[model samples]
Target: MLPLKGLSVFDFSTLLPGPLASLILAEAGADVVKIERPSSGDEMRTYHPRVGENSANFVMLNRGKRSLCADLKQPEVVERVRALLERADVLIEQFRPGVMDRLGLGFEAIHAINPRLVYCSISGWGQTGPKASVAGHDLNYLAETGILGLSAGADGAPVLPPVLAADIAGGAFPAVMNIMFALRERDRTGKGTRLDISMADNLFTFHYWSIGSGTSGGGWPKPGAELVTGGSPRYHVYKTADSRYLAAAPVEERFWQRFCQIIGLPQELRDPEVDKKAAIAEVQRRIAERTAAYWCDVFAGQDVCCSIVTTLEEAMDDPHVIARGLFDHRVKSGSVALPALPVPVAPVFRSVAEVRAAPGLGDSNQELLGTI
Candidate 1:
């Protein structure tokens, strides 16, 4: 049986962070119901790249979930939602601190209704911080947390991250982990607790090495100057003659020796202790003299710990990825179907792969709230 088959989640959150957390729960067999605003519903529904009747962004993140539209401002609707919360296993919200309290759905109120409800509030800063009321997004959170300052380009400026690191890593991941912890605690105490998940706060975990280095009087990390942030020749990206890049990570002594031999480095430059700058220059020159394909073939079976950078499309079609059945599940809507967004849930915990579709706005209102 699915692990969370009997769990019910009322997710009053839109967009990436909260939706993604509930999506993981839903995929693990929780009956997640998105409590969206009436009329427009989730703003993600109108995002670009349209699918059957919803945006691909919305469909991918919201698949296997139901939607219940209700205006919390309305007294009747608020009462109906309270009834549902009384029996819900979890509740997720993304509004600013006081918004839920003003709407009468805050943790104190809901905990009174259902002491077993795991209440999770996701925000950029947190519930009681000075910036709690300040509006911010993923980029703002990362920038404020110093994560954005660690990776600067040749121009000495922080480059924009390719993905929403704050949302997925900081917010969604922590929410899932804490929710599971809260569930386990609930099992023991027969009571649930409130989770304060601040995206910016959680981001500090990623800077463990940097934090320790700075606090230990080893000096703070400078952009592009850290070992893992493009400072070291052993762990950096090099451009090939064909303009493709090779992500090389031969950090260990053994791997570095193998990498030096594979790249045909001079005997004197092989030892990084001699002159780090000279070794980097020689490695760059040699890597730039050959095409990415040539290097790929040369390093195919070697333990050099390097790979030619591949595009998203190329990665999706990789033989290893296909063999792993990462895209075996399908997200379907009538005649339209697409690969399910790969989640980190274990296959053993998830049900068999099957076609599923994100629900239309308020699609389950009648079924879930008709009695109320």
Candidate 2:
């Protein structure tokens, strides 16, 4: 049996964070019912590019879950949501601090009704802070937490990250982890708990090494100056003749020696201490002499920790990735099909056939609210 086979989740979150947390739960066999607004539903449903009737973004994040549309402003609709919460083991919501209280669905109010509900609130700042009420998105959170300062381009300006690090890593992952812990605690104490997940606060954990250095009086690194952040040639991206990139990270001496030999660097330049900038420039020049495919073939099956940078499409179709069955499971929305975005749930807890498309707005209203 799946780990969360019998548990029910009432999700009142809109975009990425809370929905992603609930998606992980659903993948592990929770019966997730999304509680969206009556008319427009989740704002993500309208995001482009469209997949059949809904946005591909929505379909990717919200697979294998049912939807219940309700106008929380109305007294009857508030009672309908409360009815679902009464039977739910978990409640996930992402709103500014006081919004839920204003809607009469805050943690204190819900905990009174169902003491066993694991109430999770995901926000940009947190439930309590001077800036908690301030509106922000992933980039804002990253900038506020100083993490964005580390990601700099050649011009020294912070570059936009390819992924929503704060939303997925800070918000979704932590929410699921805390929910699991809360569930375990409830098993023993017979009571639920509240979780305050702050995307901005959680991002500080990603700067572990930098924070440690600063705290120990070793000084925090400037942008693009850390060893792993482009300070060292052994751990950086190099462009090839074809204009594609190669990520080479042979940090250890043995791997570095092997990488130098494969790239045909001279013996003197192999030592990183032998004029580091000159060595990096030489390496970059040599790397640009060959096509990315040539380096890919040379680095295959080697322990040099070198690889050609791949686009999203190329990464998805990679041989090793395909062999691991990462994208083997697919869900559909009407006639359009897309791979079920993979979650971190253990393989033993999920099945390919269990994947389903995101439900239409209010698809489960009749079934979930009929008795109410």
Model 1: CA > 4 A from native: none
- Please write out the lDDT profile of model 1 over residues 1-372, one tens digit for every residue: 899999999999999999999999999999999998888999999998888778889989988999999999998899899999999999999998999999999999999989999999999999986899999999898899898888789899998999999999999989999999999999999999999999999999999999999999999998877789887889889999999999999999999999998888888987767777677878999999999999999999898799999999999999999999999988875567889888889999875758888888999999998766
Q: Model 1, clash count?
A: 0
RMSD per prediction, one decimal? 1.0, 1.1
lDDT scores of the candidates, listed in order? 0.91, 0.91
Which candidate leads the pack in lDDT? 1
Best by TM-score: 1
TM-score per candidate, in order?
Answer: 0.98, 0.98
Clashing pairs in model 1, backbone N/Cα/C closer than 3 A: none
Model 2, residue 38: what's the lDDT?
A: 82
Cα error, residue 11 of model 2, in Å, equals: 0.3
